[model samples]
Target: MVSTGLEDLEQSFSSQIRNGWNARPVFVPAEFAGMRGRLGVHDVVMTVERSTGRGFESITVASIQTDEGTGRGDAATSTAEAPHDRVSLTVIGLPELGSPLPIIGIDMIALKGTLSLVALDLAPTSTSFWDDVCEKRLFALAEDARDRLVIRKRPEFAHETFSRHAIIAAARPGCEEHAFAIARNFFTLATDVVAAAMGRVGDDPIEARNRNLAWRRSERQNRKEMNALARMFGEDRARTFIDAFLFA
Candidate 1:
């Protein structure tokens, strides 16, 4: 169970993302760096290709856990108390035409003792794909932590592709009700940001076509059933189902 004191830890994480947004360099410790180095190489390549409009053909997701003493041998032995708390959601975007985009990976790191979450890295399949997925997952995670957090969408050019990140932080704790209020705020904010990011791709004719084709070809009817249910139950009900699934 997460301690109630973790509210402060959550606030600190939010502040770090805000600072990183303002300054452009979010310094992650060596532990996170190692995880990125090992797991993110493919994501970097995919992001670059997608950003260039070269297209992506396929993608995959993987879960990894690395304890202090196991993977890195002697180097990891000394830092057992400061073990890296790393979890990653890697998305590999492949273009239908030309070569496949490099893998796009987003990482979330929690400092072991502090239990404070941090944005370790947002790397795309390609150098250019940086903008494609950078702030999407980070903001989503922040929203999960608190509802009142806000993310200002700002896109810039860096490392070849256009990139943008959302600055996220919690509102004042204020009262007992504030916890739920903050959580609601984050949910709304994250949903909006994610919608905007997906809109960036879905609005594209080619991407729409790819999605339609993929959906048609998929043998599992889960997507179709979900869509039908969404239409029948409306957005709120669909959301309730999703929330239950995510939290429960």
Candidate 2:
């Protein structure tokens, strides 16, 4: 009984990302909130990007289709029924803004107890994207192994998890700008989402603030695409804002 489609979602999201007026943080990058609990949505939502085959661009937030509660937990990726009670957030964006079809982007989703799905958007946005995608499989497998083990608190999990979380943290603000057409940064929306959700649920702010500090420090830099920007403004001046990816 799905009444909405990608066009509807895209138009809705593009206009107001994660940091929109009604979004978390009160102001910032593009992000999607359920909006007073699913933005008045009563049905399970599934939105797909029109131009990309990358699974990250699309989002499905609802209960797990099935339950894989028990597994080796060896970094193996298995899809089950979406977690019914837990919030699942997915942030998707192109490899570079305005890139054509076959979009390359990252998708980060959190499950009830752990990440049911996580991966870097490592494909080129072009007809030849498949070749890049093929090269990424092995890399992804290895990375997943580390991620799964890290989730379990195995060895070196702390450092890797920090690094991994940093990347995920970066995704939110990154996508915010991509969708809103602004200078981009990373992790702002992600942090704000968690903070808002915690505050909404009455989680301890001190504890949340403590964790956010580490997550904040874990933050790192990202792609600074500004060639077109340079053309708009003078090169010398635009270079100063190369890091500037968002406007509002």
Candidate 3:
């Protein structure tokens, strides 16, 4: 299990939440060998979602580990890790369009250890405060781990095993409201990310290709869904949704 420092961790998060609101840090299993379970702290950053006009405070963390040793020769003979930065997006919504559950995230991204100057003496921008924050997170969707732990779905909840649309569609209970609500969060966050990623270049082509490929798949599918929703739910409702869900 849980190793140590659970109490201290809870106390730290307790201070971040409102006095009356519940802010329990839940234990999440570490999937990889030797990796320890993690606790999720909600309300890490609270704010109103612009899309769908819903409210949420982003979560604390959801991290996953995968093997990254290169196999140029024997496992031991691989060259020094070609450490590079990775680009990843965290979607803050649900398991499906129809379910207001945690997101389904598959993070096999690996980073070779980097050499850096200690941050204690560094400027705020240069400090690794956010780095620690990212490290603590094991997944974008809390239920991704939750499902596997409790067998929320038979055969496990591995995102790698299914397409995004299939995952969302299968889990949907056919409720428009919940699906739209969760989708609103997804769209709102996506708009912000796209706005940020626009005109930006990655460190390399592979990074750009991987990031764009994922984006295209999601965005393309989303547009199709948006069109279908308009036909079924009326253009006015769809228009209103798109307008509210996306950022200028």
Candidate 4:
């Protein structure tokens, strides 16, 4: 189903998150269901899925597809060949408070037939959370991509939130596959981290919660993202979506 390079990466990421993590589908609220018609853009689609599993407290995978009329449409569209300017996939995995696992965050964007952006990070949710092995693997994967792809400078807010080795790239003409490789490898490493966190404990819940709150606070400050959502879904719905789905 995923023959195109960008589509292949999106499908691979979704499949890995669902099957590799044994994450099941959960209910999406009715209000968030009929979003296609709400937005007048052609084939505007927004899908949000929230699930929780053994080692995770909450796992969210959402996507949006739309033409250039609306801003920041996620790649959750069903038909990749359809007339659309952008498609994006966002994944956020929050480990259980006791697991001591870093949060898994990925945002992939495909625009005008090219894989434009690939943002992947394993963000720590606690003051004292650190994994030397994981950091080494992340840095290695990120550096390889950096050498081959066009790295994008992160926003000021993201600097403190995302890991030092996070891969934020703007894949130029022939670098889509290279970008895909880094993302795939990072995802694989994320699964390995989840597996390792299964029986681990002793993380401070208070510290984790504080870090998560701070991350969300910083994320809310992204005017570009908020403005895009507001233009696409309206001010009220965009706010609600951000609170309920995006950063919740």
Best by TM-score: 4
C-alpha lDDT (0 to 100) for residue 52 of candidate 1: 19
Candidate 3 ranges with C-alpha deviation above 4 Å: 1-175, 210-248
The true-versus-predicted C-alpha distance at residue 210 of model 4, in Å, is 1.7
Q: Write the per-residue lDDT of candidate 3 for residues 1-248, one digit (tens) a residue.
A: 01011122223323432232233333322321122211121001111121111112222222222224322344322221221111111122221121111222221111122111000000011113212222123224223323422112322222332322221311221222332233233333333432333343333434333432333244334454346335434556445433433210
How many angstroms is residue 99 displaced in model 4 relative to the true structure, after the best TM-score fit?
3.6
Best candidate, lDDT: 4
Q: Candidates' TM-scores?
A: 0.26, 0.24, 0.23, 0.82
Off by over 4 Å in 2: 1-34, 38-86, 95-102, 127-248
Find the 10 residues in a row with the least total lDDT in model 1. 41-50
lDDT of 3 at 63: 21
Clashes of each: 35, 23, 9, 5
Ranking of all predicted structures according to lDDT, beginning with the best and ending with the worst: 4, 1, 2, 3
Cα shift from native, residue 236, model 4 (Å): 2.1
RMSD of every prediction = 18.7, 20.0, 21.6, 4.8
Estimate every model's Cα lDDT from 0 to 1: 0.30, 0.27, 0.25, 0.69
Arranged by TM-score with the best first, the candidates are 4, 1, 2, 3
